[model samples]
Target: MKLALRKIRLLVHLLHGMWVVATRFPKATVQQRDALNRAWSLRFLQLAGMRLVVHNDAARLDEGVLVVSNHISWIDIYVINAWRPTRFVSKAEVRQWPVVGWLAEQLGTVFLQREKRSDAKRIMHELADHLVAGHAICVFPEGTTSDGRELLPFHANLFQATVSASRPVQPICLYYEDAHGNQSTAPAYIDDLSLGESLDALLRGAPLTAHVYVCDPLAPGAERRVLAAEAQAAVQQALDRLQPVTARPAREAVGVQPPEPRVDVPHASHAGDAPAANGPLTQ
Candidate 1:
C-alpha cells in the first residue's frame, strides 16, 4: 500500500511537472530553465526513492563541454540533470514516449534518427553548433543502456562533434546501490523489461542511492576513436573504483586504482587541433 501510494504521488508530481514545462518553460530564460531542470530532477529522484551522491574530480563546466556517460535506465538522464542541467542527444523514438518524451523535447533534447544515414552528419553538426553556442551537450556514446554492471563498447561516431567544436569531453559514471550500501539492480531497465515494469520495480524497491562520478574530462583531439576509447576507460575505471572489494576481475586485471571513501559533495581534458568536419560519422 505504501509503495502504491508513493507511485501515485510520483505520477501526480510528474503530471504537474509536465504542466509547468508546457506552460512556463517556453517563456523562461536559459538560466531559469536550467534551475528548474535541476530542481525538478532532484525532486523526481527523491519521489522515485533514489538519493543522488556526486563525486566531482573536475570543475563543473558551465558550457562548451561534451558530456558522455554510460546509459543505464531512462532515469540516468534525470540523475545527471539533478547535478547539472545538460542538453542531451537521444534516439528519435524517445521523443515519442508519452509524457516523458514531450517533456524531454521541451527541455531541448536533440533526437536522432539512427536508421537514416543522412541524418548523422546533420545531427553531428547540430551538436557542434550547440557546443559552440556555449551549451553543455551530453551524449551516451555507448548508444544503449546496460545492466549497470558492465559497460558496452562506446560508439566513436558521436565524439566527432566535440572535436569539431573544440570542446572538452567529460565522462560520468552512474552506479546504483540500495540503502544498505550493496550494489542494486533495482533501477536498471534492461533486457526484456518494459519501462512500465521498470518503474514498478523501482517504486516497489527500497530507496536507492545513485553515485555520480564526474571523472576528469579529456581534451578534444583529431582522432575520434581514441577519444571514445579514453572516455570508455575513464568511465570503467570509475565504476571499478566504486566497488573495489569485489571489483569485476576483468577490469581489476587492467590495474584500476584502489577505492577511496565516498564524499557527499558534487561535482575534464585538453585538446589538440581539431580535424576538419568532413564526415563526422560513416554513413
Candidate 2:
C-alpha cells in the first residue's frame, strides 16, 4: 500500500511538473529557467527517495564545455540536472517517450538520429555552435546504460564537437549507494529491462544516495579518440578512488576493443523514421 501510494504521488508530481514547465518555462529568462529546472529535479529525486551528493573539489564551471559521464540509468540525467541545468545530447528515440520526452525537449535536449549520416552531421554542427557560444552540452559517449558496476566503452563520435569548438571536456563520475553505504544495483537500467521495470525496482528499493563527482576537466586539442579515452580513464579512476574495495574494472579486461569512430553507426535500432528536410536544431 505504501509503495502504491508513492507511485501515485510520483505520477501526480510529474503531471504537475509538466504543467509548470509548459506555463512558466517559456516566459522565464535563462537563469530563471535554470533555477526552475534544478528545483524540479530536486523535488523529483526526493519523491523517488534518492539523495544527491555532489563531490566537487572546485565549483561547477559555468563556461561552455563538453560534459561526459558514465551512464547507469535514465535517472542520471536528473541527477546531473539537480546540480546544474545542462543541455543533453540524447538518442533521437528518447524524444518519442511519453511525458518525460516532451519535458526533455522543453529542457533543451538535443536529440540525435545516429542511423542517418546527415542527421549526425547536423547535430555535430549544432553542438559545436552551442559550445562555441559558451553553453555546456553533455553527451553519454557510452551510447547506452550500464550496471553501474563497470565502465563501458565510450564512443568517440561525439567527442568531435569538443574538438571542433576548442572547448574543454568535463568528466563526471556517477554511482549509487544505499543508506548503509553499500553499492546499490536497484538503479541499474541494463540489459533487456523495460523502463517500467527499472522504475519499479528503483522505487521499491531502500533510499539511495547518488554521487556525482566532478573530475578535472581535460583540455581540448587532441583527436576525438584520444579525448574519449582520456575522459573514460578519468571517470574510471574517480570511481576506483571512490570505492577502493569494489574492483570496478574497465570493459577492456574481457577483450573489448575501444569502438572505432563511428560516423554513421546506429546507436540503437528503431522502427521507421519519417523524412524531414531542414528541421531546426532544437526540437
Index of the highest-TM-score prediction: 1
| Cα TM-score per model | 0.89, 0.85
lDDT of 2 by residue, 81-199 (tens): 77677898877876787777787787778888888878977888899999999998888888778777878889888888888999999999888888777778898888888777888
Cα deviation at 14, candidate 2, in Å, is 1.1
Candidate 1 clash figure, as a count: 5
lDDT of 1 by residue, 1-283 (tens): 5877877877776776777776777788888777776777777777787878887645457789999988888788778787788888878877677776777777778889999988989999999999999999888887777778889999999899999999999998888888777778887787888777888887776588888888888999998999999999999888887764574645544566754445553210111111100001111
TM-score of 1: 0.89
| Candidate 1 Cα misplacement greater than 4 A, ranges | 247-249, 253-255, 258-283
